[model samples]
Target: MKSSILTRPFYYLWTTQTTANAADVLYIMALTVLVLNRTDSLVSAALMPLMRSGAQMLSGLIAPLLMNRFKLPALLLLSQTGQCILFLCLALYLQLNDNNSSLVLVFTLVFIMSFLDGWTVPARNALVPRLVAHEQGLLKANGLISVSDQVVQFAGWGLSGLIVAFLGPGHTLLLTVILYGLAAVFTLGVKEPPDVESVRRHTAEDNSAAPSSKWHTLTEGWKMIWQMSRLRLLTFMDIIDMLGGSVWVGAFTLAFVQVALGKGEEWWGFINGAYFAGTVGGGLLVLTLARAIGNRYLAAMLIGMAGYGILTALYAINTRPIIALILVLLMGPFAELSIVNRRTLIQRSVAKETLPKVLSAQASLLNLVFCISLLVMASLAEWFGIVNLYLLAAGLTLLALGVGLIGRRTFHNAADPGAGD
Candidate 1:
């Protein structure tokens, strides 16, 4: 079981990844609170998710070029380094500012943090299979990684709030830099496989022969989506679900705390962190009860998320801080199940070399949809009230439920799910 957890390469990858992700969770929650506290504006909070989505979009644009041009290790180093600088800048800006009028600077820092994050993820994800290259090890590695992610997210959210409460958001940002630095150190020693250069050369040969443009290569992914009906359908459903049902997160929850619930503004970090607590709880459930219960891939995701949606709607209606936190805790597991299954689906379905591109595309789609959803959800929260806005999400979740039922073909992928991760 220990070896199962530590399978050499994947274990090392997890060491770095867990630290990086923990920092991200904490940074995002803290950043959200800091921005809102300073500006007293909900729009400033949208900057958090917007910057996040922007990072994904930026990654989608540059992933292919970076993978082709530079070694993954070098790119990873540069990405982390850039993020470190951005984080340091953010920390300094916060310390120096006596006047709270520097809202734009906060937004700029969010974008920079997200941009570096985007550049980092592709190299990170693609590197995972390299560490645990065996076939059977795929599931174990994925499960272990999922577990690690939950652990990090669990700590990040829970501890960030506590830190913010005691030490201030500046200390929180400073801690984020330390975590990123640790990730960078762990990443420094990862040995690329011998075949990596040959793979690069082979790609160069193919590119030279036809001079196939990047846009052509990328849009090709879009075209292939339709050829694989199930992939296309799942992708479509993801986009729609994000835009329709998934929009009530990030700032909406903050808005709910301030506007509808009349909770004081200082607890935004705590509120967001509560949602991550739910994620950890949900993830543990997936790891434990999966075999004994509704264990199928698509079914598990649909059922889990729908259950979460109902709870979210209930939280929206209740408006009590305690009830909201309880429902958020329930939401954690469902969120993790959805994340893990979706990644599993992508890995199983897409070809090995194409995985990066496809994953980048998936990230792009999710980002685009989330951005739109944030905008709509923000406006709707203003107009309809956060409770009604959340209720609307519940209604849309029913639609996602229908789509999942219709696309039951995904459930069948476990038997032959291909080279994803």
Candidate 2:
């Protein structure tokens, strides 16, 4: 028999999140194209991610303060509603302007929509364990969510071009607004679990530790990640991943597909689609073998980190399209496995109440690293070439793996409740 936990609220959460994910990708694609068409400047196109990342960094830093006041469901609803309104306004502005496509207005809307999105990411992640209810099932639940998220991205990005060509950017944005509205409505159906005592205990501890202050509250998540051992390790891994992840960004990947692969733009699209497909397959593998993996969360992460690095290194040297595509496809499962296990590890280690705070802090740190890496990677790419940049990314991942191996004993002890104490 199926668990009741997965039947109603969990089901609703999945549906709502998947729908929002699709809208998120669609609008991002639409806006990127819009920026290209309007400005015809690489710098303006680059600014798109910078604006969104900046908003995400700010939102993540402050989300914990809001989390203290609002429940996850309510926060999610607000995010969806906020994005819906922003998209509607942008669409209206475009329609009335007869598609003049003001760069300032477009970038501003992107920032706002992404800022709202920042809250939903951590809130939804923290809500997953609560919905699943069983610690042992967390890996399974995470795998399912990861699979759905990748699948949604694949479908959304795949169809986005066709949608924009037929309906135009304004109409495509209206479609996004509708999707956001549906997400908000579905979020209303989410039934949060009862209050966790650990949450209350931690809140009390924080209150007693420091006088009530906005700055203290805002920094609480950062303090928690730093003070907690398991969290610290995971956050470090996350930073490395973010730095390496920049290579997969639109700017870098597009350059690679053009220069290294020496293939048409269609190959660029195909390679991306293949990676997502591999990720989906990986998630399914995790779902089936999670039990067999047992408590070896650290091992799973190490293997993933190592596998991804090795594959990336191989990809950097190979000039053949078939070889590069295979490497890209093979990297997907390892990447997904690493991502899912590390997240599950955090969910298992952190107290239920504090998960959002930890996740938000982690998100903030990722954006900070990603933003910096973008600048660094771009500079390095320009100076050393794209293949060398890929090699550098692999080296960073392997560095993370080396750190993990050196700290292997620490992983075994990191999760102890008294370790932080």
Candidate 3:
């Protein structure tokens, strides 16, 4: 079973990707703490996420062009190596500078690194089918990827504060530099498929039409997603869900820890870790039932969405810290079930050649929504209070569930035709 899904090259690619992701979480968490400590201004600390999101928005828009032109392996190499260099520079800046003037440089590096990340997500997803080599294998591979990513996230976020406290910000930055450098090294071993040009040239006689104009080619991804009813609906669901999903972000959680829980800052870390730990459990459940999930994915996703809304609502009303933690922990499995199913559907539904573009468009669209949602939600939280904000989030999730029901047939059609119900 393992041999069917975990080929050698895929193993290397998975390892490289997971390591990069862990380092990303660790770096961002470290940077937030560092900035808050250095400036002692919440506004200054907030700018980092804003900068990263802005960079991601641009990156998502442009990544399709790069993916179409360059080989995936080359893009992966460049992104990893670029981040490694940026971290090294940030580490050096921290070591050398003694004033707030260096904050600009730190933000600049973060923006650039995040921009590089936008390209990496779509490319990685597009490349997965190639590495795994079969339709059945894709499900298992995605399950593994989901579980492993949650594990990495849990470890990275859980340990980051401790590591930072022990090593200090500069040393923490240096450690990330090392992690990203190692990620680059492993990425080098990924076996990229033949370039698109080579394949086209080999079949030139059979497909001799001139290529489409650059504008058409570049916009094709968006067009495909828009034209496909299922994809369009799924994309819409994602954007809507994120409106509520924004609350799970650290910014709001930090506020919740302070205002709602009446706990110290460290509870922020605990809540975040608990959420990821629950996702890990949910992913494991999905992995074990991957085949069954493939059959009823649409129902599973809708149920998951509904559960998230209900659970988040429950969490918001609870005054007890332990009870709140339990509610957040319960929230994770539902979110994971929906997310994993959604990703698998995309991979299965889209054509391989256009998958990168579709995925990139989706990422760009989602990131844009996230940036706006974070701002809007944060404002609403301030106006209405966190509990009311969560209730609003629950309302949005229920709305998404309604949309999911209306669009159920789209995903129902997506189930494996070969498999018996």
Which candidate number would show the highest TM-score if scored against the true structure? 2
Q: Lowest-scoring 10 consecutive residues by lDDT in candidate 2?
A: 412-421
Q: Could you tally the backbone clashes for each prediction?
A: 6, 0, 0
Enumerate residue pairs that collide in model 1. 278-329, 278-332, 279-332, 282-333, 347-420, 348-418
- Residue ranges of candidate 1 with Cα displaced over 4 Å: 1-6, 29-40, 89-106, 136-139, 161-172, 192-197, 208-211, 244-250, 254-274, 289-295, 313-326, 410-421
lDDT: which is higher, 1 or 3? 3
Indicate the TM-score of model 3.
0.91
Off by over 4 Å in 3: 1-3, 193-212, 412-421
lDDT score of model 1?
0.69
Residue 372's lDDT within candidate 1 is 80
The candidate scoring highest on lDDT is 2
Candidate 1: Cα lDDT at 155: 74
Of the two candidates 1 and 3, the one with more favorable TM-score, higher being better, is: 3
Question: Rank order by lDDT, top first?
Answer: 2, 3, 1
Predicted structure 2, TM vs. truth: 0.94
Q: What is the C-alpha local distance difference test score of each model? A: 0.69, 0.83, 0.80
